[model samples]
Target chain A: MQNGYYIGVDLGGTKICTALVNEEGKVFKEVTVPTEAEKGELKIVENINNTIKEVLGDVKIEEVLAIGVGSPGPLDVKNGLIVETPNLPFKNFNIVKAIKDVYNTEVFLDNDANAATLGEFVFGAGMLTTNMVYVTASTGVGGGAILNGRIFRGSTSNAVEIGHTTVNIHGRRCGCGNRGCVEGISSGTAIAKTANEAVKSNVPTSLKNYDVVTSKEVFIEAAKGDRVAKEILDEALSYLGILFANLANSYDPDMIVLGGGVSNGGDIVFEKIAEEMNRRALKPIREHCKIEKAKLGGRAGVLGAAALAITELEHKNKKDGYIIYN
Target chain B: MQNGYYIGVDLGGTKICTALVNEEGKVFKEVTVPTEAEKGELKIVENINNTIKEVLGDVKIEEVLAIGVGSPGPLDVKNGLIVETPNLPFKNFNIVKAIKDVYNTEVFLDNDANAATLGEFVFGAGMLTTNMVYVTASTGVGGGAILNGRIFRGSTSNAVEIGHTTVNIHGRRCGCGNRGCVEGISSGTAIAKTANEAVKSNVPTSLKNYDVVTSKEVFIEAAKGDRVAKEILDEALSYLGILFANLANSYDPDMIVLGGGVSNGGDIVFEKIAEEMNRRALKPIREHCKIEKAKLGGRAGVLGAAALAITELEHKNKKDGYIIYN
Candidate 1:
């Protein structure tokens, strides 16, 4: 029931970002450190604790109510455990307990994608709408849904795994052991892989000059009128469109916000995906939705994690018979 | 709120099914009538009224709490209006107003599939779990979602349009003007059409002997070891598997309940779909859900509509500052 400041941590494979945020969700200070995941769980925990300490600076311990960590998932949110993240080194990492033991404050943990979606809903592109789906096409395609202004975590709190939904049943093998999942076709890794393969196959393209073609290079080449690059982008965006359209039909959200590394390829990516969505989806499904880029940018992860902490505190307070104040 | 009996009406293209249901979700009396939809909205409304009156018999009006109707949709549930049902004779039909005017009682209307899901959750296969997806593979694939023991109505109460979700980007055209939707490949209509086309295309099969091929006959033939029939069934079931897996990934529901005519093909249908789901879906996604047959059967439509009435009454009473009790 205590109302005060909160700490939000965005834990990634390579780095940890932490911020001290007030009740109104404003960040007073922020800090970051390398995860050095290969050094394992102890090193990662130390990095997280250090980042939080650096972010807090001289702030009094009593001023902070809770800490929220948005880490790589499929997490056991109920148990406050990281089940087995694809990128993170640890299995069954008890992040909440570790943070609470170190900081002596309440800790909340959620999927990084879910945290970012909440951040967008609370402070970014989706602030105007209560219902939204946030899709981040980073190294992987990740999604989170906001329904009636609350995170729509499914039965096991591991729902909204949009990337794993199959778009092409007979297509490429996904890391999750599925064939032609949207993540395998439309994510930044997928785009880069598609480009690299096209080059290796001796396709007549400017992309062949690069030893390792990134998603950025492909989009840049496509914009400059490289036919092969445009084709690659088109294929990826088409599948991304199917994914978005399916989401639109399934959830009927008011808006879809696109974020992550690949989204930086700019309006062409959005335009192409939106076009495919409009063309492929039934009229009613596509009509009410606006496809917009995430406005919170890189800050979404920390802000969202912070927001999750605040949200969890509110839920806890309500459950304990305390009245929540705006 | 006043704890009393309610009425449920399932309005379909072919028939109108009505039932008088008590607060504890028991049906006291039931009646059915042909829709005769081509005779237009007024005639359809008359049929609906007659059916409801017949179902009520000698029951006192004051004892009835409210009426709930489940009709073919994409409906405007908020306005209690049938926005534009493709099968019905009328567009923009105010069904709630019509029923309320004739009976002089409060009325609520929802999509038939949504009502059926609620019915299943409230009284059938889904009663054991709060998070569920109900798929009816009837003439067309239809779906409804139940989350946290309440209907998961999306932004416009048009959420969970599972049928329209694309299973294959390069697959068949759906009636909803989308290509490769699950409804285009897995619905009863799709099975029959595929069978009829196979027969016409000079495929050497037992199905060629029948002038009019039905989805049931195809299943029967498949059971009797007809290769063409088995192939057709396999294709349809594979698409259905994709559809189910997609739902499993998207919602992470505790259970998926299958209802409608095609499901009567029985364990083979469920088995084939489960096999495909297990093979194609990520292990964690497929591991948590049990896909089972709908227990409510023919009673689902009426019961769901009735549940909708009670639920609506509860919400209304709660909103009006009244505490509801059974």
Candidate 2:
């Protein structure tokens, strides 16, 4: 029963979710844990390892082929290391080897968004598509590309930092220490930050002064024709339009699958983004693409990691039931 | 000599240059003429046709395999038609068919910049590389991408519009109907425009009295330490650095080839650009890339078109003389 199991670990700052999936993309079991990241790198690694063990409690170690871990970057995918990631205290950590040591199997490591893209490609939106782009617009914007059905890591693994491409020269300052990044304008934090400032500025709107207002509330209020909310919504949509247009210009993908908490705003954001991208994007480009929300939701991270392992399994299957390459 | 004659034309707004290249990436003969848009599209077409005829003068028609025309877009590359390029005037014309009718051979058409990138791949800096980016900082900030050694055109002809990607959200307005585009910040026009404004704002530079100071003059003055010029240089370099970093994150090219007039500024621009890109680009990305100047000059245009054709020939040879689908 456990002969072909694979593991997926979603390593987040506040929570960790690990899943045991089969080659058919079905989750057999999952374990979720609170990640006390402030407790430092060793603690988080221990937490991640425990989550994997719990997910595999009923399965034999020999049954698992490999474990896939998805977390924030900057990561060295080639050497399976996390090099100075900001959220976690780990500096130049070889997380892949450590996980392999425990699981006694090979491990695959990738940036969280990239892993999610792999997840979507297999069990989610990108199924059967030859070329696609998956962009996550949550705390910060990030992207991953699938070209000819293979993960496209730019020459330096520096590919797909879509959030940092400048949308406005004189736009807001981003946490990345740069200005006008897509994340600076479209992420959940940015939206909430905008909402808070407008409420404080005494802008005429239905939104009142609240201690904190998330991007979710802004979309909810804007739907009710709250003037302040619309203004904020328009700003976000405009930035999104430009960013989408730029993405279209850069990667001629067949589809762009949007994910993250903000995408949950639905048509409130989609319509405007479509209009602007169409208006600005030109020739063989304008309507040659379709923009859609990512079909997989909260499970994208965990499932995506599973998808990675499943893909590895398929590749191995092609070579007489052995992993293609280490 | 007649066995392998091919025509390549690089059409500019002010003039048109046509070359008849042999199979060895060498120009056997060429002709150049003025393109008077004011006189209208017909005249320009006539001039273009004459240049083609002149280049062919007495050469055996059967020797030519195909003709490649590189002009400013928007155009219909598939049908060999010119839609309505920006710099060139023609409400919407078909230059490809026009040449095909006169020359009686197959024809190929692409955006001039894209044509130049293909040229670079076959005959210039991108010669041996697969994943690469070509940015021409001349009249406008034009970009072309060679992914796996083939020109990557988006769904529409508008793919690879690097200049339109904003480096400054609130900076200058762009002609593509956007604001603060990469072109508006880093193009030759942008540099000269910024220098013009700096001079007008009384930034205390030695250039205050010049009727007009170009990007070249600005670079020279900046090299000589004029404060206004230096400040403008730094600003231009910063914008370019961010632009380059974003492209790196998106494309993950092994190399970025810089061209155009400003690129000729060489080390002054390169040093600052490399520093900023290295500083801003995320990890695992900066490791496997190199930034180099385009070795081909004005010759890149015609040569690129010629290279485009020659590569096909070499590919045919590699595949045992079977023509591959382009």
Candidate 3:
């Protein structure tokens, strides 16, 4: 293994989390701070740097292998620039340069999805798999793929947009302006919206007891045997299952790691997905491809950023003809 | 380019086509022979050998760089074994060893879809691109992909099974025992099946004039302004569009090359696909990903075999640390 530490910065809308991690994925120190977006881009950058410095502690700068930043997209990963994102104030911001100017070491940047994918590939559910797909179904559906043991970024660095892929040709329109997208039909937000619609329609359900009903409440109600809640969950989860089956047929991955809020729905989620795979996916693929929940949970973001740094550093070393120990 | 000839064998149930090709993808000699598959496995093997010998002509066996065979799957590509396929009579047959025994050269075996993908990547529509997907929607909807300049064979060598991917979650049952597959809704066979169903239902249309209606007759009738034919094709082509759009969202490829019988349905097919893509695909992907008709046509199979030979040889040489001129 490489004898150096790595710093990972997980930049998000609500908070910034930084960690100092070893090559084997052990975290020695960590820090978290709110992302005060109202204070502007430079302030957010300062907060990120402060978190990095806090985590460094007694570790020398010279011992650090690389720094990695995982943020929301759309980003120009090649140039390490955040093109524009809804939550962040960055507009064509050269984030890689900002980090490198402060750290004086190699820095890598990628979308949060890709970072999480690397996290799974390196230390989570996909550790031993050569080809794995990681899907996160929360407010929205997003995914990343590791094919042949490397992150598969497509032509425009926007590959594996699994959420937007249509599962129903004449289905409801998605926020991406496409109809029948898996995200529109199966995401946590989508589930909540359906529940709210049912409530507005005065449908017979325990969901009406709450002033606000989300996907989590729906899951609870469904467990209590609420008919409408079960129907809504069944419809959403079935679409998710179709999406998984489609992915299996297309990628033939060794495994698919399901992450984010919806995945935490427990046995119902896995059972539905497995049933769909058995029904839709080709026999060989369905039999071989394992569907597992992500192991990292909330720490996925920070660890994924750390993994990004490690893998990028290794790739650079190999390309530069320098032999690496691990 | 490497100074050697390559032999390509396109193995099918009805006939075997062999071609001697150069590094530049030009065929110098070719031969075709009946497979005589009913005569059994040994006879088919003998016929394949005879075709290879005929294509060899005056070229010395020592000068041949490699032989590539493209056949129907379920194949054990790693072990060069034809496990079993609906077409042809091969069960766990070591086709690679059989070819190498006669020619004393490197032999590469891949499924037809992967071979065709390589052919497009090396010599056809995707020559200049690093990431491309090839879709053949004829009797069935099958495809292959080249990502990062190499064929992306999934864990089980069944990657890029686009036909089996679902587009209409509640659509029709497929022959593969899945419901709402693109193969079940949009493939030529599917189109023909739908048209036949309509004919049997006594739908008022020009399709009733045909004793044996196929997708071809439907296309002809649609072009002649028959309302029933137009509606059938419109519905089928719309689903295909959704399939293509979903592919764009998932892959974000530089291009998607459409081939096979359905693609050759002239302007209607392309127009419908384009319309659906515009409506469903993400803006960035729709704008960047070119949807083009396949260029190789009837020669795709033979040249694809040749391409498989060239690419596999290059890959092996690279892995073995041998340098060769391009």
Candidate 4:
């Protein structure tokens, strides 16, 4: 009997990352390609299929037990459908069914953030703990909660949307129509928007030098001792600190792992966030939870999907007549 | 095989409520007595012992499987000790060991909020759904979460502290040293405080007639078409609505059951909160979740503790050669 392998795919607005991994979660083969999401749903689905096939390459087809896809959401995870994604031009697309039809194999789909959380939990920063909250501060702030080593999918499989949980009431206008959400104030997009607005206001800062101020440039300026840039970044980080503190008090997780673009600010960002979290969170959480940076970088998405596939594979084995090959 | 019974104790600052219940969650007997907590820890422990004995009167000792207690927290659940309670004069008191020594049977302990959530989940408003959030709006807002029909204790067994989660960034000073927590704006005490502050400001209202305005008087005045009363109550209810909406987004529970003193404000409060929640929450949550008043009244605490005992009994049966009778 051959030990089974898994295919993990991370589908994004601009790119699709896929990999082939064994039960041990070691990636021995990988592939990446542009998603070209603007081309429409069919093209995107076809691209996903092609990416998986490319990753499979010369491997024995029957040896691959399942495939896991981490896609941008809102999604219908239970039914394996992409409900509607802001970045991707897909609405109610049955990506899982399409892939299953071509490969005739098992498929699992979850929100990209949740998948990355699992990746971090199974193979990266969260390896030391069973319960962890993974926060991604990318173009948008996204969150995933792993409770008891399993993703905490609430009634609608959309729970743990920590980014949207209100940190400031009636403070800022969020895209989702909420006022003062973490996403509205602390996301990379939010930081870039703040910096751009400051430029438009003719703020006395070196940031005016950039044609378009990115969150990265703002961090660089802040690092170079720019007062205005420091103020904007500090405000954003403070809101994040408050958000994390609130999460710690509510969820009381073992560890909080921070990831994404903004987190690349390195030790300064991590230490500042930890101090703010400790100062503001409830007494118990301040003493108990460890705040840390996510260790898995580019591979978190695919690895997380692979981990999900492993979980699903085990569930399937217990339900069906299948047996695990060790 | 003989069927088992459970004894549950609800320990409060002022009273101790104890009950005996069968496996099906039907309460057969109960005993209530003053805690006289200020008399000190020894007297409080003796009072708890007496309450248990009174509830156990005329019962066959061999049929009782375990005893469960729901006490005021922030306490150590795993070790069965009260960390420190503001109302009760106890510091690191080993209440569980004391009870266990008396009964010599399996004993379980949890915070009152967690127990009440279980009570609601097992036999009250939460009986209809597997995943429910129980929010108590008494002296302070307390919350408990039941996921897949089990209590969701976080990594440190201190999860679901919903009241402490911030809603307004700088709106109100919470007792926990946070700004704008649900407990600071929406609890029964919070409502009363707001009403009193309005009175102190010399607002022309019927509330001035009372020597001390309570949350109930505020509700009564609101019902009588008092503008200030209505405004105060509306503001409190709105904050609660924001909180519930945030919780719905965070936990995505099938239902949110409201209990305790403030929740007793009836349909006006319930309908107003429901309307505000629907107005603010995401589309899917607005469509899926049912907001309802808690059914179990005075019995919530004792029943919740009883439910904890049942869960512990089952866990014990699965582990250490203990058998459960059908």
Candidate 5:
């Protein structure tokens, strides 16, 4: 395998973080810049290019292999186009072409969660197992799957719309206009909303003292033995476990890696999840998979992007040419 | 594309039925015999061999292009051996070798549900789609997945276990030692148990007329608009809908083919399922996919077995005289 430097960019709604990663996933250089997305598509393009240049910083750009970008969906990942994204200002943006304009090299593109899964598969907790699922519990429970050691993007780019998996047929109304999705029931936003409602409903909760109760505040209070906080935590954990059990029952993954802000609850969350999953999931698999905290922290997204860059390059080399056919 | 004669053997626990099928999946001659499984494994082997001979009595032996067998599981389909099956008396039965011994020809084997799906995929309602799911709603929800035009047996050859999918965490117990499996809530056997309990629990409504209540009796009363019957039917439908919706959401198959005796509820059941799936599934796919009645009916298992025989032969031919490893 050829070991070379490549650029990995995390294209967020408000900012862009670009890094120069060697083949071994070591970040030699990195930097960030404001996306200024509202200024129009041109500004976002210029910003990504600028961050890329800064990350490269005369580190023999001629030797660098490819550039990878992880963005929100539903994206046109095949064409490297951002299609109808909710968070970013651009729609149907030819991101790969734009990055090519700046770097004049090979480029890799995929959904943020997908890139993150590849990152985990090759370099994180998922490194030990091939069949696995990684879910990022941010605003919503975005997910990506590695089935049989490959990212399983269905015939379309939208295969693992896992957050949309119907955990409850008649549960809470999800943002996707469905009910009882993992995201709808136990997202960070959902947990905060539940806490707020309980406080307003005079549920004798410690969360009433917060300016606005969030998932973080609830976890902190729950650790202190507050009844309302404990109840809310229990509710969220059970729903998350059910969601994991669903994934386990269907795909029979060897491991499920949890990421994002909500996972900060640590052992309290992990123990409950394992217990509930063992109770709900089919035997052996429920006991088979070891659900633990993610080894990659906040930098998981960036590291995943780098892994995507290397994997795409390696796959291209395997086919004896850089055939970018989707 | 080649059309020829094929032998299909329904290797059941109690009976062995063998039929001769032309390229059109039309049976020209058929024969049946008691399995006599209690006579031990050798007698059962003799029963199968005699059934094949009787089915093709007048025809030349060389006229048979392929031999296929459909039997219960869990089985090592790849190795042509039956594993520990709950419905059968034999353990670790080397079915392929046994059949090959009598005929001195190629014999193919598959689990019953897998065979059923292949039958539907090639010659039934699923003919239009390369990807589909066939679920048999009998004692338990035995199912098979046709993914990308091939039957998908996961790492263990025991995938597509539709009955065990957990629909509710705090719901009924399942036979597979899991909580709230789709089978526990909606299988014919599970439904009959629920119907019996409701009638005995003395819910103030109709359906006490039958001394022994069953899933069939419940359906008969529900068709007439009885309140208790309606309630039981509704519960069963809701759970079934959830199971179907989850499969739809997860796999995004183009069609779902329903088989087994319970599917005789037919339009009444499908109409209710359509209503719930449309209201519950993720957007777009919510309206996507046609849930249709399976066309292969009683002979599905045999035809599927034949299809598998042909497929296995073709797959073997693809690797230049080398068998492709799964």
Candidate 6:
């Protein structure tokens, strides 16, 4: 029982990654397959089940404690339903029940952000911290917090929508229809968008050498000492810094773990973050809260889903007065 | 005992308010006295003890469950020391030890903002809510939160420094040395500063008739259709709205309770807050998080201290396996 396995399913529009993870956060078996989203709802769900089956391998279903699925939202996590999402074809689909019908074990469902946060809390950079905020600076700025040793899913389970929070009162308008959202100014998509605009405006830069410029090219050009690219990154990372500083001021967490594409911008990303935090965060908070890079990289999705299962199972066992062993 | 009594002390720069509160959150006895802060550290401590004594009246010290004191920061709450604040004369003073010596009971100390948050959570506007954020907008803006039915005191107990969180990056510089902090723009002091600046600039306004302009004067003038005053309030309240919207986005709490002087500006303040929240917050969050005025009013500080004692005692009892009756 101490060596029990948990199944994790990372449901995405492009692919469904399923893994069997052991108690020690090791992947025992795993399989990844195309989601084939355009092939229709039932077909995609079938693909998910197939991946789960592939990961199960020779292990008996009884040896698995629980299954956890992480997906893009809006989701009815309490009822284990994927209400709807832009990428996924789910519309009021009961994903947990569908998985449970075949496996007949306990299942948990959460948004990808919360799952990733749990992953960091349990086995990644946020390990051992009582309060941690996991921020993903990808195409959008989204986050989740583990507070007081538990996942904090605000009143409507929409807590930690950090990207939507305003940074500059009269700054750029966001797709969410808000002005000055950090996501609108600092996310990977935003950075690339700014670079493309600069190129279209014929601003003097090495970014124009590339037929198309993305955040990846901007980072490369900035590293090569391109002034325009450097300025774009400086502005974007400064806003990112403001976002991090705001988190430090608000949560006063033990650490803020950075994840997603933009976080991988290396020294420049961390340097800007540190600079803004020093300038903006309260003295005590800045000194106390550690800023760290997320440990999980490409495998974050699958591992996060696995971590969700392990953590939720532990919570359920605790509530049911069952002792858990290492 | 279910009928237990607790002592609450609201330690402010100008006054010391002490009260005996019952299990039902009702005040049994109360006393207010001048802090005489200029009389030095030991004198302030003595004054605090005297107020506690006055509030105790004929009740024996043994009947009191615990004592809670709420004061200005920067405090070392874990060690129960007043680390030193602007108006308070105490420097590295262990006020908790002094109070404990006099009463021989458990003593708890927290920042005034956290105490007020506890007050709202236990007996005021935030009652019956599992997650609530209490924001005080006065001469300065400050706040605290009760998350998952417990006070979330981050790593260093400085959690929920919402005022210092950036609302308008590149906007006004805060006294905290951070740019665009909500406190620098939305607070009563900030409002007064803006109005006074407008008056000094000889803006065409009825505010010129007043020899001195405070936030109260600005609110009055705005209510009376003074355009300049109205503009000042609109600008300030909009930033306040951003702060509130950020809270809603980050915490997704059940409710945000507004307290202190500026919150009393009535409809104009609330309308601005609502408009900003609608314009800024995520749809799900905006639809769910209720914005309410603090119920404790002028008595927030005293009652908040009481709530802190009660909440902490409940936490202690639960941890020690002692069941709370109320």
Give the DockQ (2 decimals) of all models: 0.68, 0.43, 0.82, 0.65, 0.40, 0.83
Candidates 4 and 5, the one with greater lDDT: 4
TM-score of each: 0.94, 0.78, 0.97, 0.93, 0.89, 0.96
Tell how far residue A66 is off in model 5, in angstroms.
3.8
Better of 4 and 6 by lDDT: 6
Maximum-lDDT candidate: 3
> Fnat of each prediction?
0.71, 0.68, 0.81, 0.65, 0.31, 0.88
Give me the displacement of residue B131 in model 3, in angstroms.
0.6
For candidate 3, the TM-score of chain A alone relative to the native chain A: 0.97
- Candidate 5 regions exceeding 4 Å error are A1-3, A59-65, A310-326, B1-8, B19-30, B54-68, B103-108, B201-206, B209-213, B319-326
Q: Each candidate's interface RMSD, rounded to one decimal?
A: 1.5, 2.5, 0.8, 1.5, 2.5, 0.9
Q: Report the C-alpha lDDT of model 4 over B215-252, residue by residue, as the tens digit.
A: 99999989999999999888888889877887887788
| lDDT, residue A253, model 6 | 90
Give the better candidate number (3 or 6) by lDDT. Answer: 3
User: Counting only residues 3 or more apart in sequence or on different chains, how many pairs clash (N, Cα, C under 3 Å) in candidate 5?
Assistant: 0
Q: Which docking class does model 3 fall in?
A: high
Q: Rank the candidates by TM-score, best first.
A: 3, 6, 1, 4, 5, 2
Kindly list the per-residue Cα lDDT of model 1 for residues A1-326, writing each as its tens digit. Answer: 34578989999998899999886677899998888999989889989999988988999766899888999887888888898876788798788888878787778889899999988887788988877999999888988998766787887777888889888977788888778789999999999998988998967999988777999999989999999999998888888888888898888889999999988997778888888788765577578888899988879989999888877787786673111221
Regions of candidate 4 where Cα sits further than 4 Å from its true position: A1-4, A38-42, A89-91, A318-326, B1-3, B319-326
Query: Interface root mean square deviation for model 3, in Å?
Result: 0.8
Better of 3 and 6 by DockQ: 6
lDDT by residue (tens digit), candidate 5, A146-258: 76566766545565667776666667899877677778878888888888889899568778888977899989999999998889878877878877777776666778898
TM-score attained by model 1: 0.94
How far in Å is the alpha carbon of A188 misplaced in model 1? 1.2
Q: How many clashes in candidate 4?
A: 0
Residue range A69-92, candidate 2, lDDT tens digits: 888877777777788766688788
> For this target, which candidate reaches the highest TM-score against the unseen true structure?
3
Q: Is the docking of candidate 6 incorrect, acceptable, medium or high quality?
A: high
Best-fitting candidate, measured by DockQ? 6
Candidates' C-alpha lDDT: 0.85, 0.78, 0.90, 0.83, 0.77, 0.89
